[model samples]
Target: MARPRKPLLSRERIVDTARALVDAEGLAAVSTRRLAAELGVSGPSLYNHFRTKDQILEAVADSVSAQVDLSMFDAADPRDWRTALHDWAVSYRAALTLHPNIVPVLARGPGRRPAGLRLADAVFGAMVAAGWPPAQATSIGALMRYFIMGSALGSFAGGFVDDETAYDPADYPHLGQAHLLAERQDLIDARAFETGLHALLDGLAAQYEHMAGGEGPGRPAGDASTPAEASPGHP
Candidate 1:
């Protein structure tokens, strides 16, 4: 019997390898030639699976988005909405942080991909299910998505200093003091993420309540909380 030849390359394999490459060496290192070399194939072989680096990047982003467990969020409990959002935000931050180099690509173009759109829909659906109107739910969901992506991109680009290194008592006395008190026991990896997510959900909930004819506790009458208000002491 004639021997069967194995498939030379597949889109899944290409995207997986591309993701690993970006995770290891940043997005700059992901090229068809480099990927082919890593996969023990000829450079032109990669074109059979992905026509260009952008396509490969898109594929990689899709793969990553697929890994997000949308079911982890709870849409039934209004009180638990903040916690659910926190979990989702934390998971998203961790995923992007692990591959910081991909943050730019993710921010720039992945928003329209099927997985990305589906994730957005899921978030919006969750919000609506939790009693928010369609427009408010959509706006809040988009706002949270933007916040998470922007924060991750900023963190990847060194816009954010590590909590340990960011504090300087001489220049930032109050911030330094607060950091010291907050991290005295343990410094959580995604404290900022959790804090931001909670603030966003809290603000959204307040808005929803107000729109539904209830006076909310978090914000003043007729004024929504801004991002600055959401992140009171954050830079």
Candidate 2:
């Protein structure tokens, strides 16, 4: 039957299967032999799609980047770029968190990677359109990557020891109250992410206002986003 249609494997399938393998186990779990067995194809057949395991990993990382939501920043009005970028960053980090095994690999660089380049282009392009200097936009992109990768690699506040005896007041009084943090571990990390994100955005807004020479971060006369959403108290 036409040689079984070349065993029905594409680069997409290989990348997807490789990603699942990485997620289920670890990066080391992915191999041509293992992948071929999982895909029901011979080991040598995988070479037709990817030349090396590292190549498969690069493709998998790009696939993950491809899932980040960029719709918020793709709107006609660009004033919401700060908020839009914040939302996008949240989605990006969430996606990276899913595949923490690949986060370190992704940090290797975005050279020749379609999904990573697409993500970078979208963020950088939106910032430039929003009146940010090219240099500033580039710096913002780099900063975002740093923040996102760090978040993926580790927790902001580790769960505290709940046992009271673990803390000897004579040695450290503060340790006794540490148990409260265990209850709010997720809240603490989320708030810290938001706080840092907003601080960065606030600084960027100031720069944009100065560079635009306009009515600060608010809309001048008629604009979408900030103007429509700006309240008397906020303005």
Candidate 3:
């Protein structure tokens, strides 16, 4: 028989199969044997491309990272920090929402993932170039990761049952209408993300102005007194 135009076993096919498994059945669903079966190849064929299942999962996570838009962080003609950060956060959240199963792996920090590293580098570099102290920039990256990942992990609105009777008015007066949220899950989640994003950027903008004017939290922009315990995360 003639050789197939496309190779039967390739790294791309392996990663794609693994990613589809993760997306459909969570990260635990991906294994070499299963991937090989899905790819119609022997299990040993996978080892030729990936040494272990973890490596395959890493490639899948990095593929999702690569989908996030980083153009706003372009050093050549960068957008203002606030605008760029907001766009990046939205893009990041969108990417994670598509592959929430991988968010846990992505949360493990850049490690040795090239695409993930580029993401962290862009956020930190952009913030520093925008005049934020390095520490604050690090905090911003961490904060964004926490927010975006948390949002992707699950839907707050979807958590509630659509049953109107679920909320007992006597004990939960404030949540009387909470049951309605699940019906509008997508709208509520999206608006909630936007509201949170706006609040974060607005707060950061205020702090940036204060720092630039040498009066933020009793320290100037270049001052090293700001609380900066947080470090950047992977996604």
Candidate 4:
């Protein structure tokens, strides 16, 4: 009897391999021939799984989205919303940073992949559970995603020089002084990811509070008493 053959590789396997390759060597390193070689299969075999390189890239993007863990925010804990959002942003930025090759691909929508849609749905759901209206939740989630992705791209670009780049003091005195200060105390150690994430969350939280307050106890226009007027004192 002939030896049993190994099971045929699926598209998931192909995309997983592509993701690993991109994470290790970047987007340019992934191609039909290269991935086939790595998988011990012929280029034609890859065609059976993915029609083209773009298809493989889309799969890889979807795979990355599937990897996101949203279970941490499943509970209705409004108190922990900030921390949860921060953690989520950090995880997202780390994933993008690790696989900078997929950044561009993800910058485009990953189409109707279940994983991609679920990721968006999870974000919006979490925001809604955390006191945002449906419309505001969707908007905030989208805004946060855009901001985080942009920040990741900038971070991947290795933002802001320390003291190495040349600077002209006469023409740009403030910038030159700022650069000097940055180098003197190593202020360049400031993390773009953390700073951007917190700032975005803070702004979002403030907006949510404003919206919620607008809907509470002060229904009619101009009938809501100011804080000072509400107090038991002459105004």
Candidate 5:
């Protein structure tokens, strides 16, 4: 028999099958046998590309990470840090929302995943270049990841059932409208994300102001001291 013009199996196909399984049925559903069956190949054939299921899962997680838009962090002007961070958070949340099942693996940190490392590096480097101390920059990166991942894990509004009787006004007075929330899950979640994001950035801006004002362990000696100069365009 002639060799198939298109390869029957490859690393990309394996990762794609694994990711699809994760997206549809969660990480527990992914396995070398499951993937091989999905790919219409013998299970051992998968070992030719990935030594273990963990490696395949890592590739799947990295594929989702690669979908995020890190370009904002590469802005020419460091003053765009606030905007960059905001945009990056949105992009990161979007990628996770699509594949919430894989978030647990990603939460373990970049590990040896190249794309994950780049995401972390971009955020950390941008914060430092924007005049933040290295320690704070590290904290900021961690904070953003926590916030974005938490948001993607589940929907706050979606927790309620549309069944109006679920609220039981007397039992949960404050939640008089809780039952209505599930129907508006998307809008509520989006607004909540934006509200939280703005609040976080606003707090950071205040801290930036205080640090650059020379009242605290201000910016390094060679760095600009004035708030306007320290983090231009900060919100």
Candidate 6:
């Protein structure tokens, strides 16, 4: 009999199954035995595709990296890096938001992951082309990753999910206002993300101008704009 057109088991198929498992039941559910069952293959069959669970998890994490848009760095104006970085951040956060289970692996620093390495190379090259020092460019990438992953992993508006009823108004009057935060939680979260994003970019913009001796992307040369006030906490 002729072999099937597509193999029954493949690395891509395994990663897809693992991604689904992670999305639905979290990373803990993606063990070889369980994933094998999901794939309708025996446990040993999985070994043909992946040596260890961590290897599978790494592929799964790269799958998330695949969702990011690196086009901003491709054959485009280098000066637009701030905007590019902003767009990249938006895409990165959106991707990870869907797969919060993969953030831990991703946070380990790209390592040998193909997609992750490509992403790092693009961002670093773009910033370096835009007149940023290698050290600063690396720092910027790390900072964005830290902020975006942290944001994606956390519930920014979780406090506003419901009224703050734990503390009585008598002694903890300040705590009682927590319920008010629940109103317009979406706007609260969006504004907060934008605020943080802008602040990070603004600081970089200032540094970029200082280093490049000219205008940074989307801003006048020597632009050192103040950070945005997204919430009551920021001054």
What lDDT would each prediction earn against the true structure? 0.66, 0.77, 0.85, 0.68, 0.83, 0.79
Kindly report which residue pairs in candidate 2 clash with one another.
none
Indicate the TM-score of model 2. 0.79
Lowest summed lDDT window (length 10), candidate 2: 226-235
- Candidate 6's C-alpha runs over 4 A off are 1-5, 77-79, 159-164, 180-186, 214-235
Ranking by TM-score: 3, 5, 6, 2, 4, 1
The list of candidate 2 runs beyond 4 A from truth reads: 1-6, 75-79, 159-167, 179-184, 213-235
Among these predictions, the greatest TM-score belongs to 3
Model 2, range 1-34, lDDT digits (tens) per residue?
4555554799988998999999999899998899
> Candidate 4: which stretches are off by over 4 Å?
1-3, 76-79, 156-165, 168-190, 215-235
lDDT of 6 by residue, 1-235 (tens): 9876977899999999999999998878889999988999999998898999999999999988989988888875563989999988888887987898888888887888889988888888787777765556666777787888788776656665464666678987777666666676657776788899999999888777666665333333554433341111100
Separate clash counts for every candidate? 0, 0, 0, 0, 0, 0
lDDT of 5 by residue, 115-223 (tens): 9988888888888888887766766787788888889888999998988887787889898888889999989999999999999998888888889888875433464
What's the ranking of the predictions by lDDT, best on top?
3, 5, 6, 2, 4, 1
- Give the C-alpha lDDT of model 2: 0.77
Q: Which residue pairs come into collision in candidate 1? A: none
> Which is the leading candidate under lDDT?
3
lDDT of 1 at 25: 85
Tell me the tens digit of each residue's lDDT in model 1 across 44-65.
8888777899889987887777
Q: How many Å off is the CA of 64 in candidate 5?
A: 0.7
TM-score of 6: 0.83
Using TM-score as the measure, name the better of candidate 1 and candidate 4: 4
**In model 6, where is the ten-residue run with the lowest total lDDT?**
226-235
Candidate 3 Cα misplacement greater than 4 A, ranges: 1-5, 216-235
- For every model shown, what is its TM-score relative to the native structure? 0.72, 0.79, 0.89, 0.75, 0.89, 0.83
Candidate 3 lDDT over 1-235, as tens digits, reads: 9876977988877878888899999988888888988999898978888999889988998999999999999988657899999999999999998888999888877788889999999998888788877677777888898988889989999999988888898989899889889899989999999999999888888888888887755233564544554354343
